[model samples]
Target: MDIQLLTRKIPIGISQCALGEPVRYNGGHKHSKVCTQLLGRCFDYVPLCPEVAIGLGVPRQPIRLVKSSPAADAEVRVIGVEDKNLDVTEPLMEYADSVVPALEQVRGYIFMQNSPSCGLRGVRRYLPNDHGIDSEGVGIFAQRLREHFPHLPMEEVGRLNNSEIRENFLTRVFAYDAWFRYVEDGQDAPRAGRVIEFYSAYKYLLLAHHQQKTRELGQLVSNARALEPREFAHQVRGGIMEILAHPASRKDRTNALMHVQGHLKDYLDKEETAELTRLIEEYRLGLKPVSAVLTLLRHYLPRSPHQFIHSQLLLAAEPAEMGFCDFH
Candidate 1:
């Protein structure tokens, strides 16, 4: 329930072009004001350009991943479309491999869409034998990043324009940022006490994901009085994966609402309770979760206000309740 954290800065990775650099194929940028304005207020951007890092100069020879053969599997060639000169695939691959490991500090990555080098998903991967391609592919660099940091919250700039997507990504980034410092810092063994302390702060967020697994994780932490670093890391990792198996959905919101409703039971009247229940029910059936919760809170809080019971306080609701969201 650290409301101050939402006001804290989040470290986010972004494509160089997205940061207003002229790194695109046509030497232009798709500068996003929303990213630079609203979200930027809370994010410290780390800009990267894989192609440029691999020694491609500004306005350099354009390269595209072309199919060498259909049967060659993923034998895509990064060749210059004009002169048919150099194949830069090997260098790009090597560069991506190097860069991914160096970016362990990043909790989230925001990539450009449809880029041959930086797209998070759905970049075309040409096959081996014939001039065929598969759209169900990710950029080589992005793939390497994901493989190295499997739990990092990754998104695209285009998608981040949506309020829900933006909020979700930001949430994950901050959560991961906190985990890195509190749980995985290597300062000491993540004892049951420390793990519980962190979990207590993130209970409600975890409930939206996997409540049962969250409890199991807490139990493991309690059971391990003298656990080694490796054992602690492994258990924590499993708990994180389970929490991130799915993002927040309407069902998750309804589950979360049930918890909050229980907390508000003594505060609201019968008529108010019915409206709140109906709102949560609607959210369970696919309406906006935030809207439903906000509507209820607005109508009731002024009459019987408890600052500690605000949605802001939900961030610290406990694992079973907080299971509603995940970062890494």
Candidate 2:
């Protein structure tokens, strides 16, 4: 059976300010066009500002994470930049706990960068003497959310500027949604057979991401009969997500594309085979985009009668409009 990816609007969490809301401490917003224009087309954002949620008024004093001592494992506090005595660390973390239930429906999240309350990483921390240390803090609210949903596809809006990171994040988000749609959300008890079927769609995609880990995951799937259905599903989902956590390197992607190309060669004429092989080689050498090769491969996909190739998610995982082809 061909696995269908979610095409409906995916509900995801985002910082209110990133959505152009003036929810910042200074009554300004760091609006992102990528979030508003690009991702907004596919995602329904549930926006929130933890500071605002905790009753901190808009235009309130800015807060920063502060290390009480210079020690490596010092206690960090979210304190007012102007008035160090004003602390809201607990409130920020508390808001994350309270809001998680509402956010349970969201499959992914995009955080605002450099926020003491929401940055996923690399937020600045301050020393007692007012010295600042860069890239030393995780936002209090983001930290709590990580603890609550370790597998969620979370990223800072700033990092989405990179093509590979943006594509990888969206890939994970789609796969996460696909899991619920195909396996997790089924009315029947989760079946090992169903989970394996789901895994089939992702096989090539996983190979593109990490060949070694993908092989290990295959081993796990081979033993799915030994484990309970729910446990098997959980293990596979975790494995799939973990493998896709990093952007696939060009070398690995070329390898995967070549493997895919092998399946079609048997059905193509000599000229067709040479053309396809040339494009794949060009893509491997970075002389042409992967899309070029993928387009030709897809054009020939109908000639062959392999059900597995027809079911491969790597071919149809991304929507054309997302401009994922332009990324590489």
For 110-183, candidate 2 gives per-residue lDDT tens digits of: 99999998999889999878899657799999999999988889999999987778888899988888788778
* lDDT digits (tens) for residues 111-165 of candidate 1: 8987767777776655433344776556667777777777788888898888667
Using TM-score as the measure, which candidate wins? 2
Candidates in order, TM-scores: namely 0.75, 0.92
Candidate 2 stretches greater than 4 Å from native: 5-7, 186-189, 321-328
- Per-model CA lDDT versus the true structure: 0.67, 0.86
Worst 10 residues of 1 by lDDT: 319-328
- In candidate 1 the C-alpha lDDT for residue 190 amounts to 57
lDDT of 1 at 281: 77
